[model samples]
Target: MKVKAYITLKEGVLDPQGKAVEHALLSLGFQGVSGVRVGKYITFDIQVRSEAQARDQVEKMCQKLLANTTIESYQFEIIQS
Candidate 1:
């Protein structure tokens, strides 16, 4: 199975990188850019036998190391391909 993960800072969290990107966009004449936020996307190939297992393991992985749950949020999906 293949897994895809998206980790993002929760709403109300400060995102300096997103802010910088927004500023850069505005600088390049792309106006109306009110806000911007950034996140991470991770994909992996795994040998899990079932979707449930993949989801469980990936969720655990994210909670344990891929994300800081106190200050951030993460969501993952198991793509059976």
Candidate 2:
């Protein structure tokens, strides 16, 4: 099974990188762009026979390593490969 995880900063958290991108876009004449938030996408294969097992393992991975959990939130999807 393949798992794709999306990790993002929680609301009310300041994102310096996102702000920099937004400023650059404005400078490049991209108009009316606001509330830019940057995030992480990770994809990997997990050896699991069932979706439930995969989900469980992925959740643990995110909590333990992939995401900050305090300032970041995460979501994942399972893809059979």
Best by TM-score: 2
Residue 17 lDDT in candidate 2: 97
The TM-score, computed over Cα atoms with residue i paired to residue i, of candidate 1 is: 0.94
Looking at model 2, report the run of 10 residues with the lowest lDDT sum. Answer: 43-52
Query: What ranges in model 2 sit over 4 Å off?
Result: none
**Which model scores highest in lDDT?**
2
lDDT of 2 at 7: 100
The 0-to-1 C-alpha lDDT of every candidate, in the order given, reads 0.90, 0.97
**TM-score for candidate 2:** 0.97
Q: What TM-score would every model get versus the actual structure?
A: 0.94, 0.97
Report the Cα lDDT for candidate 2: 0.97
Runs in model 1 with CA error above 4 Å?
none
Residue 4 CA error for candidate 1 (Å)? Answer: 0.8
Can you write out model 2's per-residue Cα lDDT over 1-81, one digit (the tens) per residue? 989999999999999999999999999999999989999999999998899999999999999999999999999999988
lDDT of 1 at 16: 97
Residue 60's C-alpha lDDT in candidate 1? Answer: 90
